[model samples]
Target: MICSSSSSSSRLGWRGAVVVVAALVACRHGQRPMPAPFKLAVFPVQNASGGTAPIRPLTEALDAALGARGLEVVPRGNLDAVLAQHRMRFTGGVDRPMAKVLREELGVDAMLVPTLEQHVADAPPKIAMGVRLVGTGERPVVLWADAVARSGNDAPGLLARGLVTSSGELDRTVVAEVARRVEAYVSKGAAGDSCGDAGRFQPRRVFRAPVLDDVGRRSIAVLPFINDTPRRSASDVILGQFVAQLARSGSFEVLDPGFVREELLGHRIVLEGGVSVDNAMALLSLLNADLVLSGYVRQYVGGQGAPRVEFTAYVLDRRTQELVWSSSSLGEGNDGVFFFGAGRVHTASALSCRMVRGVVDHIVGRRGPLGPAD
Candidate 1:
């Protein structure tokens, strides 16, 4: 669960990717009970990284790497057959029904969902990948989630030897790094850092309502964001980031996004502007969640020059029906870089990660401005 920066290097765009990889790789993950070894299925890699990046090779590499981790790898044919039978196209996240099918039909214990958030295949290649291991059961539960974003020119070193010239090599470096952490989880029962601890990524500003802290409001569900941006999947990306941060914090039970999507569809809950208090209550009951998180993505601009991301999020208590927490955040790829790209972030995904992570921290850690609810 090593969450590296855009400059992370295996040999690494990134300003100091080489140094980052070495340092972040040493960040020890928290300990958990050793999970019983079970068959794992790697879903087809989803390409939302902008442009038409070929994902088949990436998916193949994950399957091979997981197999090398000593776990049984379910064949692609078996997974495709199940998808065809159900007429489902869930490549990003698994819902409860899909997880049930995978468990009963293919005898899989866990599902690995991977999404490519950023990719610049040209020289000085760049990539940002997010992965989550979901255990199959009554509900699709996230066992672990982590992301690795890196560049090929992180550390040039003497004679520029450390520069990664091959995009293929960069791809494998990131994929292998992520998979290695998965192996670490299955073998040593160690997990990585939570989003709140990523010090530099703290929110630009936050406003928390002066509500009494209650332990009862722990479980949460992040509804689909209201995407005002031009990008079609910006909402999805931010939603996933919020969910990942909540799950990794080990503080709240995050409802599986797939289940949330299914319920929203089943109930015909259309989130045109924001989550209505009534709709929030319905979600609380239907998903058995303590809180519902909703948001609006004002702007999400990626690719080309410095990527920019801006969004606002809020949390509602199911029991009290009160707006417990809320925050507005904005970020740029070069938000905090003061020197020589020392801490410069690249890609919209990386920027959004920091933004979403910060918002999650405010909601759980209660470290933002305090005021009355709107």
Candidate 2:
């Protein structure tokens, strides 16, 4: 897949104000408006500029801009606490499933995700920034998106230009533009024709296995995924995402990973090298589960550019000791109409979420046996 940012003119100061005014006028003409007193959470801006520039300044700027527009902003401390409780980190992309979790945990109406595509502190400071507003709900919706690129006059040793140079000025301008767009979106209550384009970034299922007819409403135990990637925590991150996907699907009763891990540790069983049939059966019996879920992260690569993820998953019938279903999926961090300058982007966590959804949807299909797990 290919990822590209929306092309917006850097000189949007007057244009942004005009848009907001137009939206307010439309509201006066009987158009429904967004409800007042909405709360927003500005997630930590992601650094995808292929550099180590600080992100705190951008995040703080956005937060301040939103607050100045009369929108209630969630405190950074509270947001961080919720993320810590769920063991989640800000990674630029928040899928519908994860968005729902955030809504429940933080009670926020919307989330802002910003990505810094380029930030050069050279003579003529250059910056490219992208921002998206996502509504918190069962299925998150993209409320707005804006991207801008800016650069100052080229000159060697422009350090004499002082700290308040083109870079800082452009940053504030972009933040202000984002804030203006958000206000307009709120006042109009309509996301416009462009909203339909947001689907291009959504995760799509590429494959599906034959439905398992005999599993019925059985409890499932998801073992820790084996990580073949170089990242040491790939397994843990992917496993958590997979379990969350399964839980949200309501396909089978999912056993707690903590409980499953304790049992595995007690049995001195290491699942990194694949589980034998006998050992799988033993573990199934120990957990009193009907099916065992296992997987391997074949590839996981993340960086300043676009992150990519690949994994294979399988479901084994404990009673029959046979592999009932299996599927594999690959997700690219950037994929879409690159020519139009529009593409999906995924962070490591976001890619894992997409991969898990693909695997789970393949196994369970759209409508599966829906009932509380045993």
Candidate 3:
């Protein structure tokens, strides 16, 4: 009876020891799921050229990826109509204060930024995409990110189908990869490791001067260019062409020339010809323009008996009366008559178009208006 009792006690002790060891192993390996205080507002993917249209496909894909991961996505219809109605383009990182305004105004937690840098219509087509996770602040904290994806042709439609097939599935591949990475990060209880931090836009560094915090929206007016050409008709032609080009850039809220002239008649600036920079500034001040661009057609000569022409344009800062930008271009036409197209003016537009773009590049830097912030 004594031996039996001793054996029972020993067996009970061994069982207890095994249970404790199992509990320790479980404690070492098991992990608690990450908390859900984080929310992301994915930005529309910006194209390499910085146009918004080309990124539509990528935006859809990213939305689906985030959705599958149970991350809430702002609906496209909600913001798309708003931006279009307002004619507002999402200004890159330099608009953080503006974005923070948006966060408070729109009630979003974080901003997810994805950019499509390159899209080549190769055999399967290649898509280069980057994703960034940023928090809400005047300067947002970049929390997490994923690598760029090189996908094939069908990648374009990955977001639409909500699933990918085996053949050339770039979008699907990227979305799946991003979800896996984010999930792993959440599992590890890590935060603030951004995937392509260098490229993200931070507004503070981009703007040359302090921007108005949530400035009330204002309209704009575009005045005609003064023509100094020998031909009287040259002035009208140049100014008309300038107006059309500026409209295409989507930068200015060009007031109707006819309306401006009629309004100016009330103020006495419009004479038989256009107004000078002094009067133009007065007119712009009355019109409440943030900036005014006034310039003259310094030279316009169709090459003698040749299909070529020389054109020179100058821009004046309406307030300071300084030459902001100036450009001269010469082009050759086949008919030996100088039109806006041909030599020097490589783009497809009137000579005035080149001048307009040149001035814009100069004002914004040689990198162009939509370039990434320094």
lDDT, candidates in the order shown: 0.72, 0.59, 0.42
* Candidate numbers, best lDDT first, in rank order: 1, 2, 3
Per-residue lDDT of candidate 3, residues 1-374 (tens digit)? 01101111111133323433443344456634224334446667655422233466666777787778876666767656544665546522213343444465555554665545334443443444444444444333233444443434222344545333232365566556666655554334333222222111111111222221112211234456665666343444444444433333333333334335544656777634544667756766665554444445554443222223334444444445444444554443232325632232211122333344344333334221111111
Clash totals for all candidate models: 10, 4, 12
- Assess candidate 2 and give its TM-score to the true structure: 0.47
Q: What is residue 328's positional error in candidate 1, in angstroms?
A: 1.0
lDDT of 1 at 272: 94
Sort by TM-score, best first.
1, 2, 3
Task: Give one digit per residue, the lDDT tens place, for model 1 in 1-374.
Answer: 22321111211113223433444445435233233445678888878775778699998998888777786779998889889999988677778778778877887766888888778888777888888777676756566677777777667677889998788999999888878877776565456532224456666667776552554455678898898988767787788788888776656656667778888988898889888999999988998888889898898886656779989888888778988777788888787688877766666777788778777767766422221112
TM-scores for all predictions: 0.83, 0.47, 0.36
Candidate topping TM-score: 1
Q: Clashing pairs in model 1?
A: 7-14, 7-17, 9-17, 12-152, 12-153, 12-154, 13-151, 13-152, 13-153, 29-191
